[model samples]
Target: MAEREWTTADFDYDLPPELIAQEPVPERGTSRLLVVHRTPGTNPPREDLAFADLVGRIPPGDVLVVNSTRVRHARLLGRRPGGGPAEVLLLHPLTGDRWLAMGKPGSALRPGKQVLLGDELAIETLLVRDDGFREVRVVGADAATAIERFGRLPLPPYIARDPDQLDEARYQTVYADREGSVAAPTAGLHFTTELLDAVRARGVEVVALDLEVGPGTFRPVEAEDPRDHAMHEERFEIPDTVATAIAAARGRGAAVWAVGTTVVRALESAGEPDGTVRPGAASTRLMILPGYRFQVVNRLLTNFHLPRSTLLMLVAAFAGHETTMQAYHHAVARRYRFYSYGDAMCLI
Candidate 1:
């Protein structure tokens, strides 16, 4: 029989606005964790746990994979000619000095127009996409240097305030490196160096990969049928060392715990048809819907996602659809924090 069809509604839930966490917790490792067993079928298939319990919960000798893509300071404020303010949010970089970005006040972005960036640099619009993004080229400075010097961190829309110094440090994971992503791999945000050291000391093998997260992370799924949604493409790279480690772990019957959904996408996207992982760099637009086979990720540590989001559907596909939704409702009823800077869940 064909797999049961799923709609966008099947993955949605009601959330109180107050439950949407607007600020990060005081300490990196202090957020709450809800543990969900994928096989359970009762009223609630999850149990509440503290983030500190993670090291003890994960099985010894299991391999843990994390995404180390750094969150670039991609949001920049500038001025259009005749004194109108403009904002440029970088999506992905192209050649050395060009970027695919979205500019505010569309009128400020006609081809040949220049947005004066603060660091003695400027960007000239070369093309406007039908989707309202612009293809722009830096005029006087290296794109990377300009961004690091003057651009602000790009916080999620729900954050509700301007980026501050605290946000620059707190918004990224301790392991973040090789900068490119517009958004942080949030589930990784809960871990600090101390926490990671503890996890490693428990005999769990820890490894890293890069998945340059993009705006698609926050965009709501608009398709009526979940399968019709076009997944966003993000760049990823897997080293031979990490690939061999994961293969060895699976060969020994050890669990492969993905630190975040980004890691899940990176691993599953790199999986070969024979269920082995390939080591290489490429872009992936892979979407995980119900009935899809999971090749490598055996456990997931992820943040609660937005209603009707592609992320919600992904978690449903990993865990059972009904069981995942029940756990979400249970989380909401019990006042768990939601979204980036919110709480997390470990589904096994």
Candidate 2:
């Protein structure tokens, strides 16, 4: 028989509105975990466990890789000169006090227009880019200082409430170090410092990479054919230490565990056909669809993604399409929380 053809619709499933997680659990490491095996041609069984049980699940000699990119306070809510509400989300820094940002009321934020972010911080729209983002220059204060003092967390639109003080810490991972990403690598959110220490205690080597997650994370695959969707370029850095650790693990027959899809993308983008990763800083627009071969990331730990999302497609690519869809149905049937700030799944 010929291989089956897959489309964007094949990767989507219905999710109840109530299952969308509105908030994080009271404690970081207390969420539920749904573990599934990636082995094909078998009825995959799920092992329900606590997030804290991760330390006991991984084999001792395996290597765990995490994205340590910190979420930047990039959402600047302000008012226009004429007193209309305005919002600008900083996407990338271009030069001194200037950025490529997404501005609301796009028609109004043309060149020379200004938005007052705070009493002393304002942004003047310069030029609109080919991609529809606006080049803006910060005035009245240093861009970094202005963002730190007045910017709010760029919470996902699905979260109905405004970002509160709790979100300031809960939205980020304990190990977040490099300050660049507009969004958090949420799979890392389930790990507490104590849990990380415990994993290390079990002889698993933990390493870090930085992938400056872009706003595209919130975008869904709009193309009818999944392969036609263009991925946003994300800047990532794989340090010498991480490459060395993964190499060492591979040499010893240990599995390489990617903490989130972002890590998987980075590793696979730099991966050699032999499963060895090249270490360096780079940007990737590589999209992993159902038929794409994965050279790295033997194991994956990730959150339940949105319907019609590239994240979901990548999961389908790593785990089998049938297995992934079945697991999603199981998760929904079992009332597992979904999306960012939701429960996680471990695919082995």
Candidate 3:
């Protein structure tokens, strides 16, 4: 049999609109977990479990690397000088207090215009790009102070709801420290303090890496040819402590597991061609596709991804393409919740 070309359609799967979780489960660690076994030509049955049971899946001495990039209140609500509603999502800060962001009703906002964000909060457009993104410098207060005062949680668009006070806590992971991501590392959101302690009690080590997931993470892949789509660049850092932990795990013949796709990218980005992880901080546009060799991550714990998303492709690349699709089929058949605030999958 000839090998199939992995196109965007190949990664697509049917999901019911109602199955997309609009709200998070009230209990953080009470969500469902589906364990998928990845092997060539093996259609292994999915194991049903709860999030709290996750630690048992990892073997002793394994190092689970998690992304500690916190989700900021990136959604800023305001009005144009003409009194029209304007929404902005800060992507990442650039040099000289400038930021790259995407704004709603962007067609109406021209370069050299100012948008008023609540009382004493405003932004001046520095440049408007062909892609519809704006490079703007916030006026009045600095970024951090302004975000705290006027920003809202940048929830996934599929949720079909506005950010609430509860989302400020429920949407973030317990271990999140550094703030930069516009979206939550959904997989990590399942981990509670008790769960982390339990994992440590079972001899599984936890390590942290930083990957500032950008606004592009939420953008759907619109290209027919998956490979033709350009992956967005996100800043990532693998601290020396994390590098040391991974090296120590390898030294002990232990598997290095990634908590989410963000961790997978960070670990893979820091890995040398020979598969050794080096200490480094850099921006990665590493697009993980089928036939790509994974050097660092031995296992992945992630949430169900959108059809035709780069996230789904990364999971397919980590797990076998056929195995991943089969798992997705099983998930859909079982009516599992999909996307952010959805059920999880652990592939080993």
Best model per TM-score: 2
Instruction: Return model 2's CA RMSD, one decimal.
Output: 1.3
**TM-score on alpha carbons, each prediction:** 0.96, 0.97, 0.96
Q: Tens-digit lDDT track for model 2 on 1-348? A: 776778989988999999999999999999999998887654547877888988899999999999999999999989988889998888889876678889798866788999887687788999987878889988987788778887889999899999999999999999999888889899999999999999999999999999999988889988998778878889999999999998888899999999999999999999988788999999999898888889978999999999999899899999989889999999999999999999999999
- Give the local distance difference test score of model 1: 0.88
Give the runs in model 1 whose Cα sits over 4 Å from its true position.
Answer: 41-44
Q: Is 2 or 3 the stronger prediction by TM-score? A: 2
The whole-model lDDT of each prediction reads 0.88, 0.91, 0.87
Candidate 1 per-residue C-alpha lDDT over 144-183 given as tens digits, one digit per residue, 9 for 90 to 100:
7778777899999988988888888899999999889999
- Candidate 1 C-alpha RMSD relative to the actual structure: 1.6
Candidate 2 stretches with Cα past 4 Å from truth are 1-3, 41-44
lDDT of 1 at 255: 89
Candidate 3 RMSD computed on C-alpha atoms after optimal superposition onto the true structure? 1.6
Better of 1 and 2 by lDDT: 2
Worst 10 residues of 2 by lDDT: 39-48
